[model samples]
Target chain A: MEQTAQSKSRYGMVIDLDRCTGCGVCMVACAVENNVAPAEQKATERTGVTWLRVYPVSNGEGFPANDTVFIPMTCQQCGNHTPCVSVCPQNAVEVDPSTGIVGQIPQRCLGCRYCMTACPYHARYFDWWDPQWPEGTEVLLNPDVAPRMRGVAEKCNFCHGRLHAARTKAAAAGRKEIAAGDYVPACVESCPSRAIVFGDLADETNEVSRLSHSINTFQFLPKLGTAPKIFYHSAKEWVRKMADRAPLA
Target chain B: MRCKGLILMLSGVLASLAIGWFAFPAALYRTEAQPMQFNHAVHTGEQNGMTCDMCHEFTENGSFKGIPTIAKCTECHSAAIGSTESEKVLVEQFVTPHKEIPWKVYSRQPDNAYFPHAAHVKRAEIKCEECHGPHGSSSTLPVYQVNRISGYSRDIWGRNISGLPSHPWEGMKMDRCVRCHAERHRDDSCLDCHK
Candidate 1:
């Protein structure tokens, strides 16, 4: 097995909407693991930064006959013609060829917000305020991640800090390839119902690859031709049809 | 009149060159001495024969320990073997009190930049002298110069004001990393180096 950093691995995710309970544990885990700062006093949903957000999608029906599904939306790690990458004037957004992860470098971002506008999924977030925590909560921030400053756009990179750690551990042991279980993302690990499956989508033997090609697995906004790596699995026809439509305001 | 005009123009050109070359650098960087003098040559010399990795070791997890702690120094210097004032100060002040020495690192990069020494040294087999120059073989430690605006070591941009390196190992800027990666045919992404 080739090293993950050098190998052509399409790292992706598979979310089972049926299994999701909308517990929001994945959001909390993502915030803690990535050192995402708490929202400020004046910050609203529009202005706040959330790398992973869980939305409750419901079928329009009476309370007794209604159906709902929790959709966990992130960067999607688009593989082809990524809108954010093409619009970023600073070149801060890029899809890594080695692993199909769309990375956003906050340090290189000039707060232009072009990438945010270009992203059809509305995943990219602009930092409206400087990162802050409670008086005594600063020490609890993850040492592996450096908090982003104000005036930059940021989004999920599938917990890249963990990836770096996994690679380092492999290199120390003189192994080129990282073990499959060693590089699980925080969101996947924190999902209580195991609704999320994450692995190398290029590997046919991997569970994520198998789930991606499963009968009910569908991608969001498929007609846009972004070719996102995130695959959603739902048994309901309504959920699959809704996946093709754009998010409502 | 033409000769006088020429002389005035020449003086203006010389003044601008002087300011750009000398005065600018002087104002840009501030220098501070290390906590104490260290002789790398003495450690690596025939008597000690200590290699760079022996002191600047990599952790078990493959992270580079930038500088060794006083515990490493206390291994051999539990008692002052030499009668030099520096060694005496090391034993009596630091070693006796179990206090750590505050060594100013010349190649300390910004928080945003990640340079994995393990990958470079252990994986690529790059010598310490490749990026750090021959400081490991030097007898005396040079003054650590920091850029006032960036709060980074002057070594990051190299000693030259023009940003042109006098030696291959001088600058540790992004361009330098890119050049080496390009030369080695390694096409790494931005996230590989940036956090």
Candidate 2:
């Protein structure tokens, strides 16, 4: 695969909403893999941490015609002037130039909710309480991912821990490029329908990149010019129209 | 009245400072002793010809084995070879009972901190002594001080009361790690070190 310095790829994911079953496997997998803290007893959807949440939106019709589409949403990994990265007063969030991954430094985050306000996608979740995995589940936690504390704002980091693991393996193998199969995100890996495809969009050979260029593909809030790396593919015209809603002034 | 108000404010400041700098630190860390006084110089020094990895080894999958297990010590100290009290304790107390030596690690990072020794030691080629200091050549293990507030060892934040690190490896605060990463021109992605 002609992997070179000039070809440092922009990582992206093209998720097929058409194939999605509205199942919460990706959500559970993301929470489990990332050690996302549990919600408080009186927690709401607004406060709970879901790194990759499946948002089920309706077609806005009566019972006969009404249909739901499950869109898996995450950090969006915006490229040009990333909102969360720019708005973070503490410099806690950063878009890594090498991987095109938007990383949140929980240790550095002051839990001001500035990044949470900045993100239009609502991917960022603040830990309302200290992370305590259910009983013995703590031992089963993926050791590669460190659990964030209560006051830290956390989001989908695209399973950067797994990426680092793959990189380490590649470095040991004396290979410069991480094989695409070796670096799938928790959400993408967990999806039963293989609805989510993650890879370097800059690389033409990568399947996700190819899928991204398809006419059916669309990004959320494209008019905002955030230029998110995630692309969603849906055959339904309403879903395509629903993807690029204008950001509120 | 103004002078009295000033005195009150001054006393308040003094009390806070005392709590932060003196009383808190005194109350913060609880002193604990290691099961055995380990002489690193004896094992890793030239005469014995033993290596750090020979005892504190990595798992087959490259995860660090934090402390050397009792079996490792039994391999060499099957009987009390050295005529020292600590060696006698190691042999009789732990080795005889086949108990694990609770060697309280001075530089053990918190659960939130995910440090990959292989990435640092093998990939970056950083010497163990660089981060661990002269621990390998030290005669005895230092006192284990556990912070009451954060439940972290004082060595994690460094033994310095002022938070001003005297040596390169003294403190392991996030900034120190960032400083080192910046020096190496490595990607300081939070997950890169934190996980």
State which candidate has the highest TM-score.
1
- Tens digits of per-residue lDDT for model 2 on A89-141? 98888877778888898878999999998898998898888887678877788
Q: Which regions of candidate 1 fall more than 4 Å away from where they truly are? A: A1-5, A136-138, A246-249, B1-10
In the range B68-177, model 1's lDDT, one tens digit per residue, is 99999999999997898889989998998999999888898777776778777777778899999999889999879999999989998998889999898998899999
User: Please, what are the lDDT tens digits per residue for candidate 2 over residues B14-124?
Assistant: 999989998878887899887778899988888997877888776644456767889998998999986999989989999999998877778878766767666666556
- The C-alpha RMSD in Å for every predicted model, in order, reads 2.3, 4.3
What is the C-alpha lDDT profile of model 1 across A1-249, one tens digit per residue? 122347789999999999999999999999999999999999998998889999898887888889989999999999999999989887888998888899999988999999998998889999999988999998898767778999999999999888888877777777777787889999999999999999999999999999999999999988889999999999999998887666672
Q: In candidate 2 chain B, what residue range of length 10 has the lowest lDDT sum?
A: B186-195
lDDT for A60 (candidate 2): 81
State fnat for each of the candidate structures: 0.44, 0.26
Each prediction's number of clashing residue pairs: 0, 0
User: In terms of DockQ, which candidate is strongest?
Assistant: 1
Error of 1 at A109 (Å): 1.2
Give fnat for candidate 1: 0.44
Error of 1 at A127 (Å): 0.9
- State each model's TM-score restricted to chain B: 0.94, 0.87
